[model samples]
Target: MSVEVRAVPGESLSFPGRITRVAPPRTHWAPVYRRRVVVADVVAVVGSTLFAYALRFGNAHAHPVQALLLLGLVPVAWLAALFVFRAYERRFMGLGNEEYDRVLQASVFTLALVGTTSWAFQLEIARGYVIIALPLGMFTILLLRYAMRKWLHGQRDRGLHMQSLLVVGHRQGVLAMVRQISRASYHGMRVVGVCLPPAADGRLGVEERALAALGVPVLGGLDEAADVSVSAGVDAVAVLPTPEVDGAFLRRLGWALEETHADLFVAPAVTEVVGPRVAIRPVCGLPLLHLERPELTGFRRLVKGTFDRVASGVGVLVLAPVLVGIALAIKADSRGPVFFRQERVGLEGRTFGMLKFRSMVVDAEARLRDLAASSEGNAVLFKMKDDPRVTRVGRVLRRLSLDELPQLFNVLLGHMSLVGPRPPLAREVAVYGDDARRKLLVKPGLTGLWQINGRSDLDWDESVRLDLRYVENWSFGFDFMILWKTLGAVVRSRGAY
Candidate 1:
C-alpha cells in the first residue's frame, strides 16, 4: 500500500500504484462538537431547574423530599428525551433549524411526560416550578446552542472543521455550485477539487482553466471521479446536474463511496426552489421530485396578512413617540412635508403610495433627470451615493432605516407586508421578465431578503433573484427569520446609501 500526501486546492497529488486509506480528519470534529453541546445542555438543564426550584420554594420546606427527587429526575429525563429525539445528530449540530426544532420537541415531550406522571401518581408538583423550570431550561439550552453555533461558524470561516468536497459535473455547473458553497462557508463544505466531464479534444476547457485559476484543482474526467474521490480522501462527493452523469453512473459512484467514509450528494436541476416546496416521492419504484406552486392565496395567506397587520399595528403604536420625533426632525430639516409618499407597484401590479419620512429636498424628483448620467444604482433603479438632493438628516435616517418606519402603516392598510419583495418603482417593473413579475404575487415589504442581503449594493439580477427566492419559498417562519435578520442589518448599516 502506498501512502498519499494530503490534497490541496490548487496542487494535484499522485496516488502511485494504489492508495492507502486514511480517516477523514473533518469527521473527528463533529463528535467533539456534539460532546460539547451535550455538556452545555446538561449544565443548562440542571442550573435552570435548580434556579426554578429555589425561586419557587424560597428555601422553605413544604415538600422537600418530592421536590428534591423531582429536581434530580428532570435533568436525566431531559437529556434522555433529547437523545431519543436525535437532537444530538451530527447533521444538525452546527446549523439549520432541525437542531433547534429537535430540542424544542424534546423539551415539550419532557414537560408533557412530567405532567402526566405527576397526575397519574397523584404526586405533589408545584405548577409554578414546572412552568418556570421547563421554559427556562429550554431557553437556556437554545441560547447555549446558538452561541456554540456561532463559534463553530467562526471556526469554519477560518478554514477549520470543514468537509472537503470533490465536485463532479459540467464545468459551468461545478463552478456555480462551488461559488455558492464558498459564499456560505458556515454550511461547512469546501470545494477542494473538481472533476469535469471529459472534453472532445482531451484537453482542459476554458471553465476548467478558470477553476484552476481560482485554486481549485481539476482532479480528472467524469469516468475517473470515483477513483479520484477515494484517492483524494474527500469527505464528500458532490455530483452536479449534467447529462453525462446518469442514474447508472450515480449508482456506481455510491457503491464506490461505500469503500471509504465519503458521502455522495446529487444536485437537482432546480436550484432556486428549496424547502417544503420541493419533495421527492417514489413513483413506480423511481424517485420523482415534485415541485409545488407558490401559495399566494388560501388560509396561509390569510394568516400571513393577519400577522402583518397585527405586528405592524403594534409596532406603530409602540413607536409613536419615535415616529413623531422623526416627523418633527424631517420637517425642521427639510422644506417639504414630514412624510414622503411615492407611488410603487405592489401585489398584482397594483399601485400604492409607499410612505417614508422625507429624506430628500422638496425638488428631489425634479432634479432626478440631471443626475441620471451619474447614477450609481442598478439598471432599473436610480441611486446616487452622494446625490445633491438629500437633506442633512436624511443620511442618518437612511443609515438607521428610520425613514421607512412609516411603511408600517402601509402594512396595516394591506398595501404592504412586514416581509416580502422590495417595493419596485413603476419604471423598474416595466422591464420585468416573466420570472421577475412573480414578485408582484405578494405585497411589497418594509424589509425583506434584499434589505438584509446587500441592500443597495446588490446588482439588478441578484436583487431580483433574492426576491424571487423569497416569493418561491414564502412562509410565516421565513418572514419571521427575515424580520429578525433585518434588525441586525439595520444595526450594521451595510450597503445603506
Candidate 2:
C-alpha cells in the first residue's frame, strides 16, 4: 500500500521507530482509583442510610426487629445499583462529569427500585425511612465523590494514575492536541510518544524539530503505530486525522491496537466547543458533528444578573470587617488609597469602573514604563509574579486573592458578574480582533473559568480561548460548576500571580 503523509513534529528521538521490547511493567493505577471510589461510595451509602433509619425509627418502641433487618439490606442493594450504573468502572472514573452524573443516576435508580418494590408488595414499612434516607444518601455520596476527586487530582498532579498516550497524526493536528492535553492534566492522559504520518520529503528534520519542542519522544510513522504502542507499553493510541488515515484505515488500526491491549481514541480538529451545543449524530451510516448557535439573550441572563447582585450584596456585608481590615493594612503598608479603580471593557464593549483592594504602591502605574522589558504577562494583560512595586501587605493580599474582594461591589453594581470573562483593560480591548470581541457578550466577572483554570499563569491564547469558550457555552449549570471550583482554586492559589 502506498502512503503519502507528513510527520507530526514533537520531540527529538534518539531511537525513532524503535522502543525496547520487554515484559511491560504493570504500572496501571486503575485498580487503586477504582477501589477508592467504590469504598467511598459504600461508606457514604451505608452510613447515610443507617443514620437516616436510626433517626426516623430508632426511638419508636413499636418498631419491629424485622424492619431493622430489612433496612440493613438497603446499603447492599444501593452498592449493587452503583455497579449496575458502572459508576466505579475504571474507564469512567476520574474523567469529565460522567462519574458524578452516574453516581446521581445510580442513587436515583436504587431509590426508585426500593420505592417500587414497597408499593408493589403493599408493605406498611415503606414510609418515612426511604424518604429520609434517599436524600441523605445522595448528599453524602456526592460529598464523598467531591473529596475523592480532589485527592485523585492531587495524585494526578504528582504524576500518578495517568494513562500512557501515543498520538498519531499530521504536524498541526498533533501539535494542537499536545497543547490542549498538556494544559488539562486532570484529564489523566499523558503523552508518552507520538507517531507522525510517513513522508518521503526532506522536511522530516524540520518536522522532528517542531515536535521535539513538545517534549514527547517521536516514535516512528503512523503505519507502525500498533508495533510502536506495544514496544512503548502505551495504554492509549490517539489517532488524529492525516491524509493517509481515513475511515477504512482507522477501522483496521482500531482492530490492530487491540492486539497490543491499547485502547483507541480519535481526536477531531474542533477546539473549545462543549456543553449541549456540540453533538454527534449518525446519518447515512456516517457520523456528523453538530454545533448549535450560542444564545446570549434570554431569561437566564436575568437570573444570572440577579444572582450576581444578591450574592455580591450579601458578600460585601458579610466581608465588611475583613474589607475594613484590608483597607487599614493597605494604608499601613503603602502610599495609596485602600481601593484601586480602573476603567475596564465590559458587556457589549461598554466601559465601566472596576474596583479592587489596592495591592501595589501608588507609583506602580508610573513604574510600568521602567518595568516594561521585565513583564511576565502576555500580550493582552500585564502581570508580574514578584514585581518590585508590590507592598508587603500586597504580597499576602495577592497570594490569597483578598485584593479581589472589592470586586463584589462591582458585581453588586451590575458592571460585572460573579462568573464570566475576565474584565479587560481599554488597551486590551483596543487590540481585540472581531472574534475575540465575542468575550464582551456577557458581563466581566470577579472569577471565571480564567480564574479557576489558571489566572495569570496561562498563556495568552489559552486564556483568550477559555474566555471565549465561556461566552459561547454560557449556561447556569456551568456557572455553578465554576463557582464551586473557584473555592478550591483560591484556596490552592494556583497560578494566581
Candidate 3:
C-alpha cells in the first residue's frame, strides 16, 4: 500500500498515515459545468427580459413590436457582456467571490451598453422598461448562478466532478495539503497520490508506514512527479514549496506537465494569505509573489466604519418591535436586567463593553467558577450546553441567536462592526499568542466567520484560525457574504446552544 520516499535534506518530514488507491482521473467536469452556467445565464437573462416586457408594455401596448425587438437585443447584449467580462470562463464557473464579482461587473456593463446605445442611436427605449429589465435580469442571473454553484457543490460532496490531484513535496507538506483539501470539499480537489523526495536510506521508515495508513498512494520520487501524474491519470499536480523544489525544478515540471492534461500548481510556503493581498509578478522570467499589507486604517476603514454605523442604526430601527418583545420576555423570565454588558477586547486590544440580551440568571457571573470545570468549550472559551444559570427564555433566545441582536447598538455606537473577527473576552485576550492577537488589528464584529462556520462547535485553534482568516481578508463583499450566510446559520441553529 506504500513505497519509501527519499527524505529531503534540512529538516526531516514525516507522514503518520498510510497511502490509499488513486481514483481514475475525471477531466470532463469543467466543460460540462461551463455549459450548465451558459445555459443558466441565457435562461435567466431571457426570462427576466420577457417578464419585464409583460409588466411594462402589457399585450395591448402600441410598442409591443418594438418591445419584442428590444427584448431580443437585450439578452444578446447581456450574454455578450457576460462573456466579455470573463464570467463564462472555466476558471470562474465554479467557486469564489470572483464569479459573483464578474457577474456584477457584467450586469453593470450591460446597463451601460443599453444606455449608451439608445442615447447614441436616438432610439425610443422606454425609461420604465430599461429600469425594470436591467435590475430584474441582473438579479435573476445572480440567483441562477448561485443555484448552479450550490448544485455543483452538492455533486462534489458526493465525490462526483472532482479534479484528481497529485501532491508532490516532502511528507509533512503533502500531509498538510491533503488534510486541508479534504476539509473543504467545495474546492473540488481530491488528492489521489503523492510524490516525495528520495529518502536517505532508500528504505521504508516510520514515516512511510504512517503515510501507508492514510491510504493516499505514494507514487514515486520527486523527480518522477510529472510522469507519475500522467501515468496515474491526475487532473492536477500540486507541488508544495520546499528546498528540493527550486526554480529550475519547477520550470522543468511545468514543461513536463504541458504534455499531459494535468495542470501544475505551486503552493507558496506562506499560508492563510490569499485574495487581493497576494499577487504574482514575473520579473525577467522569474515569478515573484508580492503581498500587500492589510488595510487596517485610512479610507477603507473610514468607509467600513460609516457603513457599520449606518447599517446598524437602520437595523435597530427596523427591529425595534422585535427587540422590545425580547426585552419584555426576558424581564418576565428572569429577575435580571433586560440587557447584559460584558467587557470584551476590541480593535488594537482596547476594552469595550459588549451588549447582548440577558440570557442567564441574575447570579450567572457569580456561578461561573462552579461550572468552569464542566465546560464543553475549548481552551480560553467557557461554554456549557445545559448550564443551570440559563433561564428558560434564555435557552430559546440563544438557540435562535436573538440574544446577540442588541449588539447592533454596539455596532451603531462604533464599538463593533457588522462583520469582522469575534469579540474575544478580556480573559481570552490575556492568553492570546502573537498570531491570535493579530485579530485585534480590526474592530470586532457582531457576526463573523466564526459565527457562521460552527460557532460554539469549533475548537480554540479552529476558532482562532477562522477569526484570523477574516481579519486578514476583510472586504465589503466578504462581509456581505458572511452576513448573508449568517442568516442561514441562525436558521439551522446547528451549534447555537
Model 2: CA > 4 A from native: 1-17, 20-26, 59-73, 198-201, 204-207, 242-244
RMSD of each: 4.3, 3.5, 4.2
lDDT of 2 by residue, 251-286 (tens): 787777777767898866656677799899987998
For candidate 2, which ten residues in a row score worst on lDDT? 1-10
Better of 1 and 3 by TM-score: 1
lDDT for predicted candidate 2 compared with the true structure: 0.80
Sort by lDDT, top down from the best: 1, 3, 2
* Candidate lDDT values, in order: 0.86, 0.80, 0.84
Strongest candidate by TM-score: 2
lDDT of 3 by residue, 1-497 (tens): 34444444553434423333355745688888888889888888888888887787786563664666577888898899899999988767778888988989998998888889888987778777779888888888889889888899899989888888889999877876776688679889888778887677766655555566655667788888766776676788999988889889988888877877787888888777788999989989988898898778899999999999999999999999999999999999878799999999999989999999999998888999999999998887888888899899999999999999999989999989999999998889889999999999999999999898879988898899889988777778889999999998899897897
| TM-score winner between candidates 1 and 2 | 2
